[model samples]
Target: MDRPTRWTRATVYPDMWVDPADDPRNSDGVSPDGELPTLVDYLGRYRATLLMKCDDLDAEQLARRSVPPSTLSLLGLVRHLAEVERDWRGWITPGAVPPRLYGSADGDFEGAAPDPSLVARAFADLAREQAATDTALAAHPDPGERLGADGIAVRELQVHRIEEYARHCGHADLLRECIDGRVGQ
Candidate 1:
């Protein structure tokens, strides 16, 4: 039996998954102006990068736990990020308190089975949650504006979200590479 050729970090350019010019995560020539715009841009780019990593993969590929001892998958990441977005919305909106989308804290990963419907639902949930969170964030034009009873600044939460996305995006890159040899920006 013959195996398919798989590209690895050694075969590809060092550190980059794609060419810089062709990378979808690349920001346009215009830089984001303020703190809020910068934060939002970073978050948005990370989200897109995660999606790009999952693109062209089947449900089984998306849900494959390529890394041993870890239940992490591209599908799981999608579900987990959706939960995170919803949680962030609840944190910022007093009395919102949205229930967990996947029931248990680890349900996102544990329940990430290789089913097309499940994969579709995960993506849908992520998109809806992201839109809702963005809308909630839009209500606070001022980054310094305090939110919720804990009175965390909008800027603080935004920065945290960006950090979360950045971490997960790195995970997605590795998972994607494991699933397929495809690597670039």
Candidate 2:
């Protein structure tokens, strides 16, 4: 039996690939003028990077667990990120964070099965949640603006969003590499 050749994706830069066209999310010349926009731009770039890692992979590949003691997968990442978006967006409001997207006790990871339907739903959820979050942030031009009874600063949350995306994108990179040799920043 012969193994198939798995080609590692070639990137034009450490942070981006030379795809059919340039990946706009590769942080190409991301010149953010203000703090809020900077944070938003970073978060958006990481979000796109995560999706790029999962691009063109099948459901099974997306759902491949990281290792024996973990259930982390690209699908899990997608679901988890969606939940993260939902939660943080909720926090932007004074009210309690809305109910989590996945009600399962195991959290978003449990719903991360290798099914095309799940993949579709996860992406849709992320898009809708991101749009809502962006709208919420857009209402607050000043990053110093505070919200809620506890007075959580919008800047803190935006920066936190960027951090969260960055961390998850790191995890996603490993998962993607494990699924295939394809590696990129």
Candidate 3:
């Protein structure tokens, strides 16, 4: 069997705006039942799509800034997502605080650079943080559980995660296009 090719920003998209299940509508087959898993599934799919868009590019390409003064890059987005996941976990997991991955607060955006190693590290950190968040969510399925001192509900956090992924995925589309001619999601 042939091995699956790694994805890259230079690669043309197979299709655009389809859900993870390959359905035409982004929300198709999301979850007819109710919230909970539906929200998690949507957010997870968005996060996966964003990473897929970045797949196979070299660290240099991943770290390439969109434009001067923007400091936005595929790597930066990955790093930022790692921070977001960690932050959410910290809020929800009570006393199970995990140390920040990108140094101090705002470090994800602050420490971003065009360095190859930094880019690679950002991707790795994202993977780790994502795994931790999934584990936390699985361990606590109740959507009504309050997260953080702000008293945000688990369901609300999941919804916020979906919003975060959608917004960043949109940014990823533009950044990937800027890096190369490849377009669509």
Candidate 4:
């Protein structure tokens, strides 16, 4: 029986983006053993993935919407994630958190206009917030450490962060593909 073989996103490439030896996100034989390392490693990888998805794109491409009604764009995700990181910093640290990066409720998405300065600012904010969040998290090494009045464990929050990044990275994958038809891990 003769049949046609259709190439899809999955079967299109056994190795999605690049060769294993050349993949920057590769663990490089340093396997994370503890809960903290594992969670942080995952979070870092997802963060890197999102940045990689946005790489080489200009302001217009980065701000391009996924669909007509949806405001899901790579730049928007970056801003949203920056907001999330800032929020997380507020939770973990005992300092007065700054106001939202974008003033409006939907500013993260709606405010992601296709401007070169806005794109630069968004990436800069993301990096700054992520570094601050990482530093705050580092101060409390114990997984069982509680945060805020709700008593959410540091471990739990870390897991939640990983989940958040994972979900958004998926969105980023789609958004990037929509912009340039490039697909991979």
Candidate lDDT scores, in order, read 0.87, 0.79, 0.76, 0.85
lDDT of 1 by residue, 75-116 (tens): 999999999999998888878589999999899999999999
Candidate 3: stretches off by over 4 Å: 1-32
Q: How close is candidate 3 to the true structure, as a TM-score?
A: 0.78
Query: At residue 77, what lDDT does model 2 achieve?
Result: 84
lDDT of residue 48 for candidate 4: 92
For residues 55-139, what per-residue lDDT tens digits would candidate 3 score against the true structure?
A: 6678777877777787788888899999999888888766867777878776787687778789878878888888988888877
**Per-residue C-alpha lDDT of model 2 across residues 60-161, encoded as one tens digit per residue:** 898888877787988888888788888777776876668888887456887789889988998899889888888888899888999766678999888888
TM-scores for all candidates: the values are 0.89, 0.87, 0.78, 0.89
Instruction: Report the Cα lDDT for residue 119, model 1.
Output: 96
The lowest-lDDT stretch of 10 consecutive residues in candidate 4 is 1-10
Per-residue CA lDDT of candidate 4, range 43-127, in tens? Answer: 9999998998898899999999887899989999999999999888777666586689998778999999999999999999999
Candidate No. with top lDDT: 1
Candidate 4 lDDT at 146 equals 98
Decreasing TM-score order of the candidates:
4, 1, 2, 3
Of 2 and 3, the candidate ranking higher by lDDT? 2
lDDT score, candidate 4: 0.85
**CA lDDT, candidate 2, residue 137:** 81
**TM-score for candidate 1, residues paired by index:** 0.89
